[model samples]
Target chain A: MKRFGKLEYYFAALITITFSNTILGEGFDSTAFITIFVALTVMYKGLVVIDHFMELKEANRYLRMMMRTYFFFFPSLIILSTMF
Target chain B: MSSIESSNTLAIFPRSWSQQNAGRVPGNIPIWVGILSELTEFGIFFTAYFIAKFNYPEVFASGPLSLNTTIGVSNTVILLASSFFMAKAMSNVRRDDYKKCERYLWYTFICACMYLSFKSYEFYWNDLQGFSTKTNEFFTVYYYMTFNHFLHVGWAACAILWVIFRLRSGAYSAKEHSGLEALAVYWHMIDLMWILIFPLLYVLR
Candidate 1:
């Protein structure tokens, strides 16, 4: 039997995380916890795409850091706006 | 970073400094420039989204309730799947599996078509609900942001087709497939942008 490739596994994980984030966010009141949770999920998904799909893991340190920063910055902004 | 190898300092880093020398930017440097510009464009749009959102918290809070979550979520899934297929195609190409790479590209093209179809249906659904760019601040942001993204996806779809044709012509191989890698990266960026947008527009109530 042919098992799933590493990229396939990453894709599955991303899909799972996406749906779980949506369901949990929508199933309950949009509390701070839920909002932060969603933000974190977005960050995780972005990082996966950057590192794996974009093939940035072995990329130049500066370029890799720049991509990572974009993912972190936006999610943090989302959290910040929700707070105040 | 220089690609030169210095054997003497390889041990100090411990994580295989030799491999560290292998680190280089993925795809073409020019494509990275384009990616940066795309990111800036979407970054500005996101800024506007947050500004309007904070200004009218009630409107932002209730905006998503009116949108079609089913279409939005479906499109998100489609884009994610498309990017995955694109990534798979790139991996196959790197392994000199041109046949598999071509197959995966077709899969990605199918996903892109599905996404565009659902998105168009979403616009019609919005029209039925009497939503438009003039609806309100919330709807205005929604329409503009999503429409811009829709256009990007369209361009990316064309690029995928171009890459497919080029591959068929034997333009790519394991030893030199930067063009394919570039398209994959661009496609993933499109998918990543939507990953953020979907939650904001459909789920973050």
Candidate 2:
């Protein structure tokens, strides 16, 4: 069971989001690669919020899994479609 | 300023509040409804965006390039900082540091203001650059999606102000701060939505 302090998770998310811009700026040839990277970064940020900021670290498994699934599944499809 | 010691004079939360509400939904049920509705509304817009993007790849690809990535990144940082302070306010409330909580919320409000400042500048700049809802499919989606979110931020700003007033009025405590927690969750949802929107609209170009 992994848990993070709220401030730590926020910093982690800020860095991830800010960092994605660099990859995106590298020109369009690698847009496909950065799309995948940005998708996964978004997922990680969502999971951190669900787990830490929302304090779902100890919530019911059903609710936890539900939010997790939505965050994981939907953005994923968008990225997949963008790439393919 | 009401001191925490003086706060003890008021009725504290019943000791079993946590144990009683254990295993329930994350926060107050009504907030979950608000959050879900917001998510559903954004979902529809995002679907339309992607559908339009797929059909008009050239426009979607060129769209973000015209927009200023610097403003987008800075706005994201400001919003994340606002969310950070909001979370800190919640943790302070959990610790019975009502004064500290109120201070953190004010900080969050300041960050919200800063976010709006950058956002306003971006919109003004876009207008000067001749981008509008009628410019093209991409701007249509961009203006609609971003403006709708801007509306939510307006509501969130008002809510934070109200909560700050209530915090000063001695309306909450360590063990009985569900309303504060719910507000924090809503703000976090805004941050989460932007996490998706920032990368989708600006970065993934």
Candidate 3:
């Protein structure tokens, strides 16, 4: 389990670095890449880390549901508002 | 049948353990609420950023170019390191290593202080350069967001200090360390908010 957790951390770091460099480079589109990265990272933290690993889901069902609602609502609202 | 064995059993089965861990397995509501509140605040900032960008893109562009990217990047790294230490502190508490927990908490607090100092330097230099909050809408948001985050850092530092004092006074056990959990959650939230804010305001503006 610990090794798996370490692997996950490495993967996250790799993603962050790659995306960061890409965003930094000229001729790269910022909006699409940032939106994608933010969505993926937030989902990973909210669903995978907090809910699964942190055991928040088991501890507080209502809070878990509220989190799910929040993750779904806020980003989508922002994206939609930006779009139209 | 020695006195030491009896004392060991009593230590292992303290009354506080049952009382503290009884409410929920691991109470993390304080952290949950704190993060949610921060997310709302960040969302508001993002909305304002979009509004400013739509109205005056050139102004926002000039603002980011003037920022010290090196300091921003260093602060990001520092906050990430603090999160790691905060996690370690929680782990120490779980293992009933109060001394180690206090040490890690102090390290996290130091990182928080360092982050605030860098931020203060940035703000001071900006002000000396005549970039006050009244400079422009862009500078207004810049100061507002960063200053608000600084307040959070100070609050987290104080909480960490309180946790250290509690640990020293034997006020927290492995089972009853809600304070540590709360501090860790707040520390992580602070780091997470910066991860977004640094790139948005400093790098990608």
Which is the leading candidate under lDDT? Answer: 1
lDDT of 2: 0.77
Candidate 1: residue B76 Cα off by (Å): 1.2
lDDT of 1 at B154: 95
lDDT of 3 at B116: 90
Candidate 2 ranges beyond 4 A from true positions:
A1-6, A26-28, B1-22
Give the clashing pairs for model 3: none
Clash numbers, per candidate: 0, 0, 0
Quote the TM-score that chain A achieves in each candidate: 0.92, 0.71, 0.52
Worst 10 residues of 2 chain B by lDDT: B8-17
In order of appearance, the predictions have TM-scores of 0.92, 0.86, 0.73
Indicate the docking level reached by candidate 3: incorrect
Q: Candidate 1's residue-wise lDDT over B51-128, tens digit each?
A: 999898989889988998878888988988998888889888989999999999999999999998999999999999
Kindly provide the TM-score of model 3 when superposed on the true structure, using C-alpha atoms: 0.73
Q: Where does candidate 1 stray beyond 4 Å?
A: B1-22
DockQ of every candidate: 0.52, 0.40, 0.20
Q: Determine the iRMS, in angstroms, of model 1.
A: 2.9
